[model samples]
Target: MACIQVVIWLFVVQCSAVCFANYVLKEEPEYKHTLLKRILMEENFESLESKINNLTQRVEALEKENALLKHAPVAFLAELTKSVTSQNQIILFDSVKLNLGNAYFNVHGNFIAPVSGLYQFSVTACAATNHYIVLELIVNARVVGKVLTGDTGYNECSSNSFLVQLSTGDDVYVQHKTAGDYLLANPAAGFPTFSGVLLNVI
Candidate 1:
């Protein structure tokens, strides 16, 4: 009877060990599969995030470039070197202070519009001790505006500004109304200056 009990106990112990090993085997494979899935998902997510960041940066760069290109870049600041005597003579702003995009404001003192747009023009004149003259801002030889400077014995100064629409290839220059009257020259060269800038592209 004792021998029979020993055999039965051995069989029960063996079956218990087999059951524990089967449980361990089943749980380990499930854990490994879950871990592998998580790792793959994390890698994929990181790759996608990197691509998204790159795309976002490119989009921002393109937006900045497009904003700059919205308006045609053109600007000029010129000053006359000497006094003009003739009535319809073009006051050459010989100094190249700032000429952007090209020589739009050339030695002939004409701000030729390269694009149809609104532009702001300015002219400052200094009065001499014995001269009086009217300077007109003429577009294509038509008197659009004028600024008068006369000797007041106080080193008088006169300046005029205008905002006008100019088409492509339109000519803009200053002209004296009378031939005999003269515009006073400034030794500093900054007092008698004519400048124009495009306000906005049309």
Candidate 2:
């Protein structure tokens, strides 16, 4: 009887040890799997967030480029209506052949810059027979270019062009550098004209 009781007790002890070992093994793997899954989910979320931020920045840059393109084309051409003779006088190119942006005013004979940018300007002048004319291209009260036309044996024309940087609201026009008898109006010698175009935005 004593031997049988001891055998029963030993069997019970072995079964309890095996059950405890199986439970620990199963629970440890489930915990590790859960931890790994959570870490992977967090990494994926961070990667998606980074990609979204990069796309948003690119979209903003494209919007700015589109706005610049919308306001890019700016140009004008004007011709003198009458002769210029006095010193320090504003040469009025009253006949506007083309005015894309309305920046040139025929009344005041000046171009007010609508936007800040680099600009290219041109001026054509003519002199009557036996007379001479000196013209200066002025920008905001500063002389940017000059031209002189004289009787080189007959009526003739002279032209000048320059590139300059202008700010919004800056004034540009042609003025007589010196007093003269008269400026000729002939089609053979090119018409007295003033023209400008925006080259680039700064």
Candidate 3:
């Protein structure tokens, strides 16, 4: 009976030991799996943050581009008008006539260099007879190119386009052959007008 009791006690101890070992092994593997999952989640979060930053930068850039496009046309027209004279003067047009010789007319402005690129320039004029209007691209007080429009009737208008390479300190202007009130008479309200010249950088 004593030997049988001892044998039973040993069997119980062995079973308990085996069960504990199995539990330890299973729990360790679960802990390791949990650690690995955490690491992967951290990596994914970092990747997501990077992508968000890039998207934010792109959005900001697009906003700036949109603003520039919105203001471009107005800036272009203002530049053209400002280039005509150094002082601030009101532009007047009545019945297709531009009162360019009004006592307020002043044609003096400093030319600053524009961006270095191919620039397109255009001039439109209105006259009663086929008279000549000379458009000039002036750089540093020198005429780079002189464009002449042939005689146009008082009720006629003409446009000329030119490709010019402009640097800083470039200027442009239109001179009429006749001094008498040169007006552009056309259906357009500002017909005998100098819409002023435009320079499109390409």
Among these predictions, the greatest TM-score belongs to 2
Q: Identify the runs in model 2 with alpha carbons over 4 angstroms from their true place.
A: 1-67, 187-190
Model 3 segments beyond 4 Å from truth?
1-112, 130-132, 146-154, 177-188, 192-202
Where's the lowest-lDDT run of ten residues in candidate 2? 181-190
Against the correct fold, how does model 1 do in TM-score? 0.61
Residue-level lDDT of model 2, residues 115-200, one tens digit each, is 88889999988997789887889999999888888885887888888999999899999888555667766543338899999886
**Alpha carbon deviation, residue 91, candidate 1 (Å):** 1.4
Please give me the total number of clashing residue pairs in predicted model 2. Answer: 0
For candidate 1, lDDT tens digit of each residue in 79-157?
7767766675777777767777563565577878887778898888766777777788989988888888787465566
TM-score to true structure, per model: 0.61, 0.65, 0.35
Q: Model 2, residue 57: what's the lDDT?
A: 97
Each candidate's number of clashing pairs is: 0, 0, 14
Which one wins on lDDT? Answer: 2
Candidate 1 — which pairs collide?
Answer: none
Model 1: ten consecutive residues of lowest lDDT? 100-109
lDDT of 3 at 153: 34
